[model samples]
Target chain A: MDNYNYASFPLDMDDAVFGAFRTQAPAAGDPAPDGPVTDLATGQRAPLSALWRSGPAVIEFGSYT
Target chain B: MEDLAARLGPRGFAFAFLYVREAHPGELAGHHATFAGKCDLARRLRDRWQIARPILVDDLDGPLHAAYGMLPNMTYIVGQGGRVLYRAMWTDAASIEWACDYLQREAQERRTSKRVAPFYSELRGFRAHDQYARIFMNGLLEGGGRRAADEFVAATEATEGRAAADRLRAARQELPEARP
Candidate 1:
């Protein structure tokens, strides 16, 4: 995906970009990727596992827009 | 999501919102040029929305978001072992709550009932959601300002709006004529 800067925000004609680039979601029981995430308050990078180490977690992903 | 967090938080369920690239970038919120800029937008989003759950911002390229499927407003349930328990293309609070409740009950059954053995299974294709125009428009406005919202409206008008209206008209035509 190209950099979605302000100028390039509406570059895609429709949702074609998503259709082409959307990744298949991890199925149930699959190991969730433990990628690094940035904490909003502290700006410190931490492992994604930190969120669910104690128990299960419901994580919602989206942008401000 | 806040309500879900509150309802299920005590039940050993955690919640967080992962901030990603703007879904509809425009002038106001625009695209995140830098990680710092993305964080700033995320902070503003938190303050503006008064989100209670912990906000975790993704990296600029969104490796995690892409890995988990790039659909906007997607949700996932990660268990203690970092295993995906549930995932949905769209975030529906009712569906999420149902999944959590079901999982918790299964856990309880495993602990208390020796007869029932837990096994992995996938339940899918149960889709119900509310898509109100006002809410969508609000998000567009927040992200890209008037231009984004306007463009979205125009696009919808060109595609879904006309197609849906045409389909509705055709369906009506198939119905028996009303008595005078």
Candidate 2:
């Protein structure tokens, strides 16, 4: 098991102000925050670091209302 | 996303959806006030949408969502080293597919490449769900929904332009009731 501290990750949510609407994505080579997220299929809590371990990952952030 | 996953999974590409707060909460699946409530709604959404990819639920406060632009629908591509390669404000399959292709080429070249410029394409006459749209549109015409719509429109106008914002508002008038 790997212990990861999310606080160390360079995550700046404030820069992503909703109405500002960034035309560009986060810059390449910028490290992504390995925050805690729940896997709905297995009902297990894991950091994003666990998900992108193998290779490239495509993540879609959304809600089903 | 599933289609992209299927096509790219064999090529060392992984796909997943990070379920955030409700986009349009109503009687069927109302807003989640607690972490547990959000988890329950996430399960329901996975089942309802028949989502094939793994669904990850964000915390009640939605730190992940806020970190990634806080949009209702956003797409991101992370490279091998947990670096964000591409991002889209809205979920557009075509643009995403193009990004994937670009990534594949970059991977083959075995070199760190420049970020692909963002592309926007407005799909005319695209409908998510007639039944759901009717309910959501009706909801948007009301109190909280109206405010959300206004805010979204203003945001769009500020970002994209008034024409784009007005088009989004016009979408409300086109919603049709579900077939009986």
Candidate 3:
């Protein structure tokens, strides 16, 4: 079987340009990226950084199905 | 994660779920080929799981998921200044609890010292919850039977390798029969 690159084909992480996997996440002291995300319930767009402005945030990424 | 969020959320810790692409797509709720379809699935997910925290959905193509290692379940703890304090490949309650404790203590110390803390990384063991595991296996069986299981196993094996797929199969075998 071929090496299935989920990061590229089905879902492009823009790894070649952004190097997302190099660090896996923002550094301890570095600022987190304010990426665009839509509120699932409300269908509104907002930067993720805005959510954690008040304090620390615990983010869990997953799906139901 | 929800339980921890409830416990720490009162203490100024924001907990949110980022809804990404489907892990085990089947005939019932298969993969989303469009953004609207993905959003609909997200709604169904929120209803099914009774997810209380704010849920942010990624784009249909999954830019966020890919940026976050494309894992089915990944947890990240971001501290003050929006810095990533911890990242777990798989969601482990014990490790997250430890992280919460560490962050709370650090926040307290920062009140007086105003010092920055270093990053902490550890290889914590993964503990699968029995009930949820059963639900997942049963869901696979109900969704499409052996074919669903096979597709799930294949997907897991592709991303996490054969060991993880084997573990899933073992768990599925232990599931009790469904009532008529």
Candidate 4:
């Protein structure tokens, strides 16, 4: 697998660049094991699906990035 | 540096070291880099650097850090009105010096504008030097999970002006709307 160079992409256009680069972004119907989700502030239990949201959030998508 | 903060003064700036979850707990307490025992290593680091600023420990459960959304290691510079002026993860001699310079410039601008400030007294040099270790290392606040809701309230008031206070009161007085 070819490594993507996200650093070279401009901040404003990075999302678009990623979409084209990845070619196949996750769809709504994927049945992969749910990712572990924790409320960063409280370290409390949260829905795994809650990770996908529209808002400002610090995402640490390690290795898969 | 002590010299920098002194030149910066009480009006100029204030520094708070929020001790959150330790990356290397063992390294902090002189055991080893591996995570192990809990000890106040911030004091030792501050003393070595001759820092005169107040360093507070985060709550054992890290509620304070959670409130700020702070990650493992970061330094935040909050302005006079409690507005976060700058934030950086980790600190080094050169990085801190540049930050100090930026903060000093900000202080000068605020002074010129004559803005309302949360005033604090000038910390004495003799006291800072003598008890630097104790002040920097020991827990400043008894407990960490204090509500910074007041800070948010102040910010809202500042942005929307005095008239918004009436709206805020009404909202708090009213009940939540029932879902259909």
Best by lDDT: 1
Error of 4 at B47 (Å): 5.4
RMSD of each: 7.3, 8.7, 5.2, 25.2
For candidate 1, write residues B1-180 as lDDT tens digits.
888888899889989999988877777877777899999889988988789898998888888887887766889999988889988777878889989999888778778865675466655445433444445555665567766765665565555677754443343334333111
* DockQ category of candidate 2: acceptable
Interface RMSD of each: 2.7, 8.3, 5.5, 18.9
Indicate whether candidate 2 or candidate 4 has the larger TM-score: 2
User: Could you say which candidate leads in DockQ?
Assistant: 1
In model 1, the clashing pairs are none
Model 4 gets an lDDT of 0.35
- Measured with C-alpha atoms, the lDDT of residue B154 in candidate 4 is 40
Q: In candidate 2, what are the lDDT values of residues B1-180, reduced to their tens digit?
A: 677788878877788999887764544555667778888877776776688988898877877776776677878788778887777677777777777887788666655655555343332224366465345455544412444445545555766777966776667666542111
lDDT of 4 by residue, B43-74 (tens): 45445555455444433444444444434444
* Model 3 spans > 4 angstroms off: A1-31, B114-120, B129-136, B142-146, B155-180
- Give each model's whole-structure lDDT: 0.75, 0.66, 0.71, 0.35
True contacts kept of each: 0.74, 0.62, 0.57, 0.00
Each predicted complex: what DockQ? 0.57, 0.32, 0.38, 0.01
Q: Tens digit of lDDT per residue, candidate 3, span B54-106?
A: 99988777776766666767788776677777777678778888878988887
